[model samples]
Target: MVVPEHRVFDPASSDDRSIYDRLVELGGVHVFDTTATQLHSLRALLPTPPEDVLGEEVRWVHYPWRRSLVRVLGPRGFRLLRLDRNRNKITAAEQDDMARLCVGVVGLSVGHAVAHTLAIEGLCGELRLADFDDLDLSNLNRVPASLFDLDINKTVVAARRIAELDPYMSVVPYPDGLVESTFESFMDGLDIVIDECDSLDTKLVLREHARRRGIPVVMETSDGGILDVERFDLEPERPLLHGLLGDLDASALKNITPEQKAPLAARILDPSKLTPRMLASVPEIGRTLSTWPQLGSDVALGGASVAAVVRAFGIGTPPPSGRIRINLDAHLAAISEVEPTASGESISPANQPR
Candidate 1:
């Protein structure tokens, strides 16, 4: 929808004392703070208020900020004002357009961070989140959660976090994860989809469905903050993984065991590009861990990267299809293991911490 441009009278504006008078008369409220945030109401963003103004319409909206509730009022007294804290960073026009788009994300392991990043940055106005997994003690490292969140579904936790940040943004949680029953509703009307799921088959299925609908999918890899964009919307014939996994159709990926997943994933990701630790662990799948290694630091970086990429795509300036690998190791110094020197004495390398 084209957002109609109309002049808004700010109650706090030096040029508009009439606006403040009108607000006081209409039982409107404004934040008591000196920071001059625009007065807003429960229907702050709505195009128009209903004819029957309920008794609650006179009530001041109390927003939970910091440690207390901050009471603020609406700006719909004499003029329609738009609430935008993003300012020059995100233009009012862009924000208006962004508010219409729906973005869905699957998996709340690493995806929890992605959900947080997007919601906080206002990159997506509506987020449909799916994940059957509950928060474990291990998830605290990467998921931006506290001990209080343990035992709760990751999707529910993420939704609460987003609500805390931006209550105006809509967040729908799928506690059961994405299943055949919820597929259509989850993907419906979404401009783009985020695939951060751990399962290979699910990822393929998501991409396949998204491709058919001409909806682009953005996936962030945990190791190196790799941003994978399959612009199936622009290039409908483009294969999943950019056709890297040749002839590895959805049928081949379905019903596969973890042991079977190891080699196939190695091909799609090019095992040479994987970290030494991850590369070593893939072969030990049945013997050791059931899933790939993931780090909190990498998940954080990947989440941030996805937020930026989604904004670009949402604004119609999407990055080209391919991988953009951002390796933190290149920037931050990491410890190296001791190795045997030429003389056979064990020694630490220059990069290794003493």
Candidate 2:
């Protein structure tokens, strides 16, 4: 569990114990100081006098999980330098507006990449992450985790990584994945919700709530870079999942067997849209593979794609509700045809679904 109170420490605060004394108490803790570089960058960005910029107080952020302390500029100066490269393209004003939004992500497999990208791009001020499962050893193929993270709750792993990257960002982790009990609070105050969970019932439930609340929902299928967006915020009357699972409610999906889930999933994610490799893997799931295949590259690409859509929503230029494929294979194909076994042959055995 992430103790939000102890996440970031401000040495400038009027604490009873001095920061130096506290550091001495917590011996062997690694301390990182980047205040000088941050101040220099701050000076270059602003026309304010050196004295004024120099007067900006430095804060010490403590990462209790890592037993490390980092010295950084205050929120204003830190954000300026952290997001400096987003200039003109994402203008400072746009970034500031983005920072005010709150985003929630469910199912931490693909959601892990989405959450990390959101934090790295400074797209949201707070992130609410919910995933019931722990990090499995086999999840490393696409999950942004490691051997040490094995067996740890996925939400905690993701939240800790985000905290290490930007202590200023608020991350709330729900170890127990979403259920009827926590769903309301999880959806509360969220400007956008990203569904990456594996449960078909949960997906239906998520949209039911989002539609009622008029909150937009985004989902990315690791196959074919399929991105699904439901602008419930703009069109409250819109059908869930673009009416793919016509009038099917979560209640009907409860306790469904694996055999029953396959056909419904196909209906939801049209079989015609599935990549050739993914379509082929469907029958072999129980025979050769444990589950559907997802590649790290595809997960990473989906992360970038989702971040772009979320950013558009933040800037109030969100695309219409629908599904779109950002298939890299189709876009980056060879221009000329070649005979079998020819040099520079594109076909490879690794192209099969993992």
Candidate 3:
């Protein structure tokens, strides 16, 4: 596993000067100092006036993967400034509450987007990512990765990106992927689990463990923007995948090959509800298509939708357990229809906007 390396340096400490000097000498380092802007925002967001002598304690964070060093305020001030814009929408108290959550995500493809949104929004304090596969060139179409990231483990790639976005966030990478032996360690202390992996068997196993622990599970299938929120936390006895598999034991599907996963995956993501393109593409996965087609647009929407559900869960207003769709194509199709105008009025055909 290629773990991400980072360190915080307090310039006032003589003990940290030697290593900081070495990093400077290594060269090719990009330095960023935004404490001035941060302080400006921090003071504005505070309820009451702070101390007369507001001494600024700046910290420098070094990311070896990107070879960049950034300067910012201390943790409290940094978080306040970084997430200041989320105020009112996600009040200061709510933001603080979210920071205490530990979210685990399996399957780094769509999981990558979920983790990115969670990190960007400061939705969780710690994130655990699991995926055994490495980045392939074909994944670039939907995955936000480049040629330089080729061959890197998916978990490592997502973790490094999250670290770069928020060094304050704690990211644990499971490059070896999830298995029966490692399941206990992965489930330990997870407040919520997001399933994005492709394996039908792995999906069942994740839900089973989460149900036993009474932790909610969130899943978003990029097809038709299908989002499944199973609130096992509230309904501990809720059937796995909403009982779509009909009492199918996860153990029976263990070690199943990729060829066998397509049909099962379709069952979870009902084929009849899929978009015409996706429904058509499903049958050609091993034939005409490389794999089930996934658009970057749909994946991006899935990320935002998943983050919305997680935020609701974080704020103590969890949505009911059910499969919901936020299909853009369907919405667009509705827009093309001629519905009655607001005020019981109807626009003439010639008056309609082109």
Candidate 4:
């Protein structure tokens, strides 16, 4: 049983008498049982005597069983009763498994959306949130924060909100983004990591770290309507990102200048296969340093969809790895699963973005 640190329970004060006393104070016990056991149960279950009174007579009431009976039979008893009501519908083993999941989400921009869904779904026992960016006016359009949170860092805001939503949820906030120095501590004792950061460097680092640690990762790329779930637990013979960047190390890859990176990225992305609408944003984005283009609606869609995938994975449902693209424009979605070629070269898809 998970015990909440702060449970709401109010004991009767000197100003307040027992339920039977309050009931008799009205006139008589009009709606109460006559038998001792039933009366005891009724007295135990009443929260403030149902807002009515019958007479004024101080009766001997059992104080010990009051809270227990209320918990088991009162109007708000569903909080406790629902646990067993849905038992047959959910596997006992699966519920037990879900209660033990600990997931770390990096980047609180879209991650806030993911955390909101996960906290509401009661999917994780503990959530670790990381981000260094502060909330800006522009974030109001998409992030969970508002104008009130304008100056506050996202991780701090997200942690407080998560606590308010579910007090039992253990939330650890890292005000700094995960870098080489912070990676080990942040990744420690975590069952899974969800990459929601916008930095390609951070994504690459997280993927490498997860691969090294043999942890599974579910990353959401709202810009491309892509959700990538990588299962390092499977121990694929080739290195990580084999299907995306081939077998080149980060140092070797970074030595290529921006001019070279562009064509390489274009080749890897194969923009020739992109629809005109998809290509339209590229020129505008290219003028501004080639940051990825994201549709506003993709944030909500990707967050909710990826959260569902995470819950499914948590409950032991098998999900495919690699990129799962949901093209809202075309009302189409596809899963591309790739394996390294015989020569250990990555197989590039025509429509995938670099």
TM-score of each: 0.72, 0.89, 0.89, 0.64
Query: How far is 82's C-alpha from truth in model 4 (Å)?
Result: 9.7
> Candidate 3 lDDT, tens digit per residue, 244-296?
89989988897775456677878888878978887777777777776788889
The window of 10 residues in a row where model 1 has the poorest summed lDDT is 1-10
Candidate 4 local lDDT, residue 212: 80
| Alpha carbon deviation, residue 276, candidate 2 (Å) | 1.1
Alpha-carbon shift of residue 140 in model 1 (angstroms): 1.8
RMSD, candidate 3, Å: 3.8
What alpha-carbon RMSD in Å does predicted model 2 have with respect to the real structure? Answer: 6.2
| lDDT, residue 229, model 3 | 92
Model 1 sits at a Cα RMSD from the real structure of: 11.5
When summed lDDT is taken over every stretch of 10 residues in candidate 4, the lowest stretch is 63-72
- Tell me the whole-model lDDT of each prediction, alpha carbons only: 0.71, 0.85, 0.85, 0.62
Model 2, C-alpha of 130: deviation from truth (Å): 0.8
| Deviating ranges (above 4 Å) for candidate 1 | 1-85, 333-354
Which runs in model 4 stand beyond 4 Å of their true positions? Answer: 1-93, 236-238, 251-278, 286-290, 332-354
Q: Which of the predicted structures, 3 or 4, would earn the higher TM-score when compared with the native?
A: 3
lDDT, ranked from best to worst: 3, 2, 1, 4
